[model samples]
Target: MSQRIVDHPVLGSLAARNQLRFTFNGTPYSAYEGETIAAALLASGVRTLRVHEEKGTPRGIYCNIGHCYECRVNVDGVPTVRACMTLVQDGMQVTAGTVLPTPLKKGGHSQ
Candidate 1:
């Protein structure tokens, strides 16, 4: 853990891990099942979580408790998920959509 949080005050307690592996942008990392996705990312030194609809607007964990959608990310191709409220899973591929390599697709891309 880098900018770590072994235990949090409001998210309740956590169980000891038997050790599991997952990746964020192809980099392997670990976290417990009950730990929030945002918490895990932050613990592992992830600051910027995703970009907003407006280009260049940086967003992260504005509210650690999940009220704000700033921590939104696309999990397994599904978009607009609140990471602060989602728990981590073993072998889960957590890709940080904090910034897009391409601009927003207007009117959706036609096949």
Candidate 2:
């Protein structure tokens, strides 16, 4: 798939192609480096970030910007990250955190 922001409703066409690779919950996914995690998630058709904090309600991207933390997900082993704020990186190991994003502690070390 084309990582460049060729066409988007909010941001319009991206200026250039930004190829990058990363993982989501142990599964590999693709996107451009530097693009906000939220935008990358949306581009990858990954709606439904995680269940609500209290009621466990389903949620997804609303604003591409970082004003809302609704699209927050576990990234680079960090929990409660605003995907829209964090930019993608090469060889990044991202973890989905819609629900309980607590890092999987492996012998007290987060994997």
Candidate 3:
């Protein structure tokens, strides 16, 4: 099943838009013009955008209005760019942010 809303009673039919190509975590995906990165990922069945930076818990789109950062992802080497707010760009490369590795202490133990 397609995640896209093809038709809406109040908004009328969704106008066809040119397809945009992008990648998430090295995997290719397609998006229509004007769709945000989070929307594109959701349409492609990707529910988990990233894990918590420190907790390692899975995080997806929340609030979706740029207030919550759950949908943040790495884009073209930039970190913490909110996927929910950023529009998809052709040839864009996106990556999920993962928990940072614990710092090692002088005795070789994790700090």
Identify the candidate with maximal TM-score.
3
Among all candidates shown, the one with the greatest lDDT: 3
Q: Which digits, one per residue and each the tens of the lDDT, describe model 2 over residues 13-91? A: 5655667777776777777755766677677777777667645788778786778778767767778887778888878
Error of 2 at 107 (Å): 30
Candidate 3 local lDDT, 22-90, one digit each (tens): 999999998888889999999889999999876789999999999989898999999999999999999
**Total backbone clashes of candidate 3, pairs 3 or more residues apart or in separate chains:** 0
Please state every model's RMSD to the true fold in angstroms. Answer: 4.5, 7.3, 3.1
Superposed model 1: Cα runs more than 4 Å off: 7-15, 98-111
Which residue pairs overlap in candidate 3's backbone?
A: none
C-alpha lDDT score of every prediction, in listed order: 0.73, 0.70, 0.89
Select the stronger candidate by TM-score from 1 and 2.
Answer: 1
Better of 1 and 3 by lDDT: 3
| Consecutive 10-residue window with the lowest summed lDDT within model 3 | 102-111
Q: How does model 2 fare in lDDT?
A: 0.70
Supply the TM-score for candidate 3: 0.84
Q: Give residue 39's lDDT in candidate 3 (0 to 100).
A: 91
